[model samples]
Target: MSPVPNARVLFNAIPQGVPTPGQTTVYDSSQSIDLESHPLNGGFLIKTLVLSIDPGMRTRMRSTEEKSYATAFEIGQPLEGFGIGVVLRSENPDVAVGKYLQGRGFLHQQYFVLPSLPFGMFFLDRHPALPLTTYVGALGLPGKTAWAGWKDYSRAKKGETVFVPSGASAVGTMVIQLAKLDGLKIIASAGSEEKVEFLRKLGVDVAFNYKTVDTRGVLEREGPIHIYWDSVGGETFNAALDNAAVGARFMECGQMTTLNSVGSHAITIENPMAIFGKSVSIHFITSFLIIPKHLEEFNRVVPAALVAGTLLRSPEDVRHGLECVGEMIRAVQSGETRGKAVVVLGEA
Candidate 1:
């Protein structure tokens, strides 16, 4: 067997207010790293590919009360997220070497040295019929977010009308498809004209450019939306409130539109009057706090939907190399990129 060679790891030091060229840091290797043989628990080394750059990451980058989800990325520590990786070495029985897996909290490194349990690892077997990247996209977090939020929070019934903003995004697209499968009438809004057309092809009953037309106005004439699964909060969430049916359910899953700010321009709905009067329920959803029971249910429901034709998988937007990982964040922030922007670290 060949000896283990040195690995290069890159980390984001000093959070810049905005992403510019040559602002982040890249290291050859840290000499401080003890390579000496030591007992490793459930040990595994992974070569990362297709790193997930999610909006939740933006909150984690900050140092505030809202950053309670996960500890903020340290100035000199490896940045982390859900990523697909190939196992290069392993001491764990469950995780064998040479297998591919999807891992959460994986940095933008070419190789990872995991000392603890693979708490977030989901074994990704080769799907001959499907692209592997889908494990990090449609069959991944975004897809899971759509599925879990809709299934648990919305509790959507058949023949109900569901409205989703940012409907062309990776999660949004999956939500649209899942809602349709539940036999719900799907109405969607997107930023651009092209996205509107894209949603139409996905069987959306009414796809509109939210930038051109007033969402609430359009919905008022349309009448009685049963569920509003919001991916983009701020104006979109406020607008959704206006169109919500008497007993409608609303799921606040994400806050992409407000960037990282906490302020809400939300008009106070008379909760005791309008909502209590109408008996509508508002639910805030996040997969981060999901319990083991819910996660087990997720593991079963998700893979099955993916293996079957129930969920529609969107193509992943891949950015090559660890250095370009910032571009993935920028794309989502700018609202320029469609679907999930993943950084490919090594060759597939």
Candidate 2:
């Protein structure tokens, strides 16, 4: 067979803040395998289908000297993230050709070859009822993140009022739906009017545009929140801390608000006494850690819930082709995307 044309997105430069087009570049090339000389040796080649664009990728865009939970993307290397792919050729008996799987190391590439299925990699159990993109959105890491926050950390109960910031976000959207299913009264905040409406449709008891409203006043009106699922940190997080009910649980999921900011900014609480007086329990969640610890529970629950319609799948805002990846990442970071921003490479 002739060499297959391939294209991939490369991390070209370190970003000062939010990444731009110059920081990432698309490289086109061709790949070929010699079947006789290098017959399948416990490896597989996959056709990239859908790529997941996440805010967490920003942290990786920085230099390795800057410590973070994940390793930084090396300059001139392919930018890596979660993506869904179809196995095009396989030497490994465990992985069959034509099967779909979700894993890391997805660049803006047409085809990728892996020596072996890496840790955290799993074959996607094709569900006729669910769209393929849904696996990359809700039923993927985002949904699992929501599950970990509510079930393990927050321990939200029925009739309790739970406040969630970034309610229109990939993880936050799932958080709202899951909280509602668990019978909790949800108060959610978003950046735009459209997102506020989206949260309401997702069954949040109250939805507000945090950009326009006074978060403290909003919390005061809804007072004594039993749990706060904080996806946006900074001032919004401080507000949640201030108004938390006695014994309220606070789950720190992500700090999307100031994630792209270059330098340190003061996010001090005016009254630390409020937290001390309430005996609020605060738990910081790193979903990568949580996902592995609770993989069994997630595998057991999420699929069934999805099939039963108990958990609504988050919407996927897909940008077609590998070239659009940089712009998609920017849109996600800038709060321009209504749902989970994904880059669709090709058909299933």
Candidate 3:
């Protein structure tokens, strides 16, 4: 059998600011795979289906000294990320051939032969009501992060107002839905008018373009925010700090303001002492905090909500093939790719 082109998005060089496509990341399709003869010592061979490019991956492009919860992407190697793949051949009983498996830390390639299934890998539902692409968006890690924040960090009662920054991002989309589900009022913002329009479509109490509006003024007018979904750290965060109500809760996730920081992520807070004055409680949200029951509940409930037309599905920016993967990666790093950015390598 002819060797198959195992194209991959390689992390070639780290960038100081926004990553440059074809420079920071390289697309290499010259590598070939012998699907028929690739080693499978109690292992499996999989053809990549969809690869996810997330904003968090941008941080991993830096040196190992820059520590984070996620492992740094190895230079000259395939960038690992959340991806769905179909088993082409397998010897492991648990890894059935032809089943779609979802995994993090998957070598971003067209085809891969693994010695064994990656840890935490699992098969997706056989007949999901939604497309498999949704797994990389609404049901992906970002969704999980949103769920964790709402379920554990956000201690808002019904009718209380929650302000979400970056409300059009992948995490932001889920945060919007979660707030609605719990009967909380939402005041959210995006960087663009188009995204603001989308937030309005989602039926938010207030949606504004952060680029144009003064966040402090908006929060003053419509908030004393009961819950602050803090993804953007900087002046916006300072504004949130100033506007948070006494005993308010803050769901702290990624500090998106630092993604393209020219130097260090450090930024001066106008009123760092405001939280103390207000007695605000800030909770760090992570999927690790979500137990197995939460995952089961999420799997059961979110699907039903989607089927019942109760949930606003995640907005996605999709691309196809390995060449375009570099483009998407660069777009995400540059904060240009909205919602979830995924690349399709093969069909389900």
lDDT tens readout by residue for model 3, 76-177: 988888888899999988888888888575678888888776765778774456877877777777777787668777876899999998898778888898
lDDT of each: 0.70, 0.79, 0.81
Candidate 3 lDDT (Cα, 0 to 1): 0.81
TM-score ranking, high to low: 3, 2, 1
| Best-fitting candidate, scored by TM-score | 3
lDDT of 2 by residue, 177-217 (tens): 87887799888888789888888889988899988998889
lDDT of 1 by residue, 1-348 (tens): 333444343445434443333444344444323333433566877667678877777656654444365666665566678888787767888778788888586776666688644567777766777766777777777777777777677778998889988788888888898888789988898778878888988899989988799887878777578898876776667666766787899887766666534354233443345555666788877675543335667667766667786666654567776766666676676666656677777655
Best by lDDT: 3
- State the displacement of the C-alpha of residue 183, model 1, in Å, after optimal TM-score superposition: 2.4
- Which regions of candidate 2 fall more than 4 Å away from where they truly are? 24-41, 265-270
| C-alpha lDDT of candidate 1 relative to the true structure | 0.70
**lDDT accuracy of residue 325 in candidate 1:** 66
Compute the lDDT of residue 281 as modeled in candidate 2: 90
Clashes of 1: 0
Per-model TM-score, in order, reads 0.82, 0.90, 0.94
